[model samples]
Target chain A: MTDDATRGPDPAAMLAVAEEQQARALRLLEPDGAVIYGAWGVAWLVGPGLMWLSRAHDVLPIGVAGAVFAALLLGAGAVTAVHVGRRTQGVQGVSQQTGALHGWSWFLGFATLTAIMAATARAGASDDLLALLWTALSCLVVGVLYMAAGALWRDLVQYSIGVWILVIGAAGALAGVPTNQLLMSLAGGGVFLGAAALSRLRRRA
Target chain B: MTSGPTLNGLDPVIHAESRLRITATLAAVDRGDRLSFPRLQKLLDMTAGNLSTHLRRLEDAGYVEVTKTFEGRTPATYLALTDPGRVAFATYTAALRALLRPTDGGSA
Candidate 1:
């Protein structure tokens, strides 16, 4: 065998080809930015709704109820997000890892919004007109929330319809309306029931 | 024809063992959310340095990305799979599935 010094030098072209392969291999994976995006959206929807509830209860002595409700709902959201993150810790794929985050964001956002509106109503806002207006807006916004979540999860359920009722009820309440609870009830109740419907469908399938 | 190892989309040597484990772990949790470093290390049953080295390799490959932020005074490490990593893992799984499927002759 020839000595190391006598061996022909490694081909320059071969080294270039190997380097190119390494670079190409490294180019394939990009971190899933969607996870962060979903988390931010969830935070935004809940945070604003919580703050609004605190403001709506201006008549209340210390806004204790509103603040408590905000803490609970937001706390729940944060817990859920952390739980999901832990669960998917080493998982691959954007779609698979984001499933829980998407679900958590949708439900928490809706619940927080609903609770805020309810707190506003109970705060002794004597102006039925303003109460109605705020409630209607909450319904519409909740509907949009449901719609967003539904699209992500890909199943149409009663929860989506509930959003519509919340919107309509708020409108009626604003227009000197009386006894328009059905809309609000449907929207609020729809969330739990909608989740159930999806579960049932999955089981049957 | 005998099928062999491939990289990305091209035939190449199989990935290192540590990297392979990281990929499998991530793939299993794809339907969930992010994973913390401590949890990942525990699940992989690896030393902190070992797992960190493996993670660095995967991150260099662009299959995973790490986010470091402070939770109060403590630092937190969160990991998530990138879109390309997901696709690569899926393809790898499909190939494995195909290989594992029973053939017409009743031997895999």
Candidate 2:
């Protein structure tokens, strides 16, 4: 045990009424944690994965199948997020702060992604280069956000997911846009769904 | 000479565990909507009678406001932190910080 835990009860008990009460609120919060993360992940990553599969529709348009798959996965992800985020507990005080921070951080990432995409499109960048840049940068954003979320909540799993996304994103950049999208969709979606499932299981238990 | 920290600013009303949890929980919602009674009951692990009793105390102190609404004929009670309650919680925390801080830590 650390020094504080080992120490006998001191007169200066930190559990002053207000402090103790705040701690209770924090504990009850458990934070909005990974539900949102998983939801976005499944939606963003898995939808694209299906798109890649549909590109095999030689009988149809070149990417018709892929487009259909992406749309469906994206739809599913959105629905899942709404369903999961509907928590019985009103947001806890600590959670309120963190959720706001995390939500904004991701929003910033999306904004950045949009800016980069728009700039590249205006520049008339080649399709391949544009795709590569988008995938790489997107990966970095996802990774960093997950890391931030993990750090804020002191959850290693969340942090690891962030790290994993970074790796996938980085690796995809080198492998070209198609490969990058595929890897991100498969690995990223898996991670999101896995985390979501774990969260659900914990809540059930 | 400086006196040590005291509980003068501590809100005895909000200090109790259940009420504290309730207040903090209500305060946490960013949208400023009332928390349903069943939600509080589950979150705080309080029995219906116990939850209502503590809520009554907070209501009496003007720290919380409770309203009853019907969701398709099933009556529902929602609890929200009043303006005074928020102010009280803030004042309580400021006092708490002062008490927790070192009296002579300004070792410049």
Winning candidate number (lDDT): 2
Give per-residue CA lDDT, model 1, range A1-205, as digits (tens). 1112122222233233333433332222222223332333334334333434444444333346436545755665576567556544444345553564767667676667668767766876655544455556655665676567667656465345545555555554654333333333343434444454554454345
Q: CA lDDT, every prediction?
A: 0.51, 0.67
lDDT of candidate 2?
0.67
Residue B108 accuracy (lDDT) in model 2: 36
Highest DockQ, which number? 2
- Least well predicted 10-residue stretch by lDDT in candidate 1 chain B: B7-16
Q: Please give, for residues B30-88, the per-residue lDDT of candidate 1 as tens digits.
A: 33356678767766667888778767766776788788877689998877667767766
Q: Model 2: which docking level applies?
A: incorrect
- The top-ranked prediction according to TM-score is 2
| Segments in model 2 whose C-alpha atoms lie over 4 Å from true places | A1-45, A54-77, A88-94, B1-38, B41-50, B57-108
Q: What stretches of model 1 exceed 4 Å from their correct place?
A: A1-126, A152-178, A193-205, B1-21, B27-36, B42-50, B53-84, B105-108
* DockQ of candidate 1 relative to the true structure: 0.09
TM-score, chain B, predicted structure 2: 0.84
How much does candidate 1 score in TM-score? Answer: 0.45
DockQ of each: 0.09, 0.11
